[model samples]
Target: MLLKEYRDYFKTELLPVYDEKEIDSFFYITLEAFHQMKRVDLVLKPDFELDGMQLLQWETVLHQLKEEKPIQYIFEETEFFGLPFYVNENVLIPRPETEELVEWIINSVPEIAGDRKIKILDIGTGSGCIAVSLAKNLPEAEVFAIDVSEKALEVARRNARQNEASVTFWHQDILNTDILSETFDIIVSNPPYVRNLEKQEIAKNVLDFEPHLALFVEDHDPLLFYRKITQLATKNLNRNGLLFFEINQYLGKEMEDLLQEYAFENIELRKDIYENDRMTKAVRKSYS
Candidate 1:
């Protein structure tokens, strides 16, 4: 079966389930992942054939996509912050908004004291995207990550190793913990912020396939992770330390208020590429 032939199949079948652009993306991504074939290869060798077994696997994945399984999960890997991470049902797929959070941290390194090494911690690290990205990009910093799920931690550890980023992974529930063994210069969390009530807003692809343990909080306490992490940050951050969060767009004002209540100064909220208020940074103050 020629690869070009499948393009028509996708346009006819997948277009009903996914937009034309997404179908095109799936086609190219599947080609690259399975055959190491580039888009140019398809155009240049329009008659190039797919073996029977290859066509079988491609059809299988097409069914999964039609059921709204994410392309990332189907491939079991994704690129985040310009690095690759192994993902599974145990870990949530990293997002572009979270990459913006990481870029914010990387860009803020100049504000940190250059005389000493910066210490960074990522709470509820999931696939360890933030911790590994920071470790890889900010090599001078000491990076650590914690996740409650041992299964998720296994994926995070693999991601750190595969990315060659030195991040220490810990198994601990962020909400139950009160203190770290030592203080950090920067603590960041992109923890479970999606309230149960907001689950309807999530696409079936995510709601069905992603790990709920890493995505949700009680509807009544949408700020559960934020409040707990801020409390821990208060005691666990060094004076003048920084705190950052990839936040729920609907709860940005509540996040700011929570930071202010904790006396974290210079609170700033920033929008993601989609213009949603998606990231926040605050500074811990020193008492003279």
Candidate 2:
């Protein structure tokens, strides 16, 4: 069948489940993934056709999309910070908001002269997105990442290798650890911040498929990971070291207060493109 005909079929099959724009996006993404065909290719080669085997593949993806499965998981791959990553149910799909958080970290890193390497630790690094991205960008930074779930760590490590980013991966439960093994110039986390009550607010695809261990916190104590990471930062961060977090949008003020209570200085809260309070940075106070 002609590619355009199949594209229409794809849209019709998913229109009940997704909007027009989203269906178009899924079509283009799958087109590139399956046939190396871009949207422009379709327009340029209006007579292009898909073989029987390729048609079956498209149908399978269509079925998954009807079930509201995320396309990233369907392909087991995604792009993060302009680098390719392997992903699955074990790790949360890296979001654009998290990219903004990463950009903030990359932009905030002070250039040190000579060979002085900036040390960075990413706690609960799900897909190692932040750590890998920083390693790829900064080049001189020694990047380390920790995740409690060994399965998630597997994915994270694979991503680091695939991206050719030099990052050390550690499997440890941050909440159970008393102190980090080494001091860092910057420490960042995009740990579990979604409360159980907020599950209703999450999209069905995420609620059904994403790893909850990387997404949730107790409603009674929504700041669980933030507080613990902050405690660790106080002990393991070098003087004037930076602490960054991708926080729950609802708890910005509380996050600021938590850092302030710990005497973290230069606290700055910034929003994502959506203008929601999504990320924050604080500097560890110098102890004379």
TM-score of each: 0.97, 0.96
Candidate No. with top TM-score: 1
lDDT of 1 by residue, 6-27 (tens): 8799768887788889998999
Best by lDDT: 2
Query: Backbone clash tally for model 1?
Result: 0
Query: Where does candidate 2 stray beyond 4 Å?
Result: 111-115
**lDDT of residue 181 for candidate 2:** 90
Tell me which residue pairs clash in candidate 1. Answer: none
Residues 180-265 of candidate 2: C-alpha lDDT, one tens digit per residue: 89999999999999999999999999999998888889999999999999998989999878999999999999999999999999
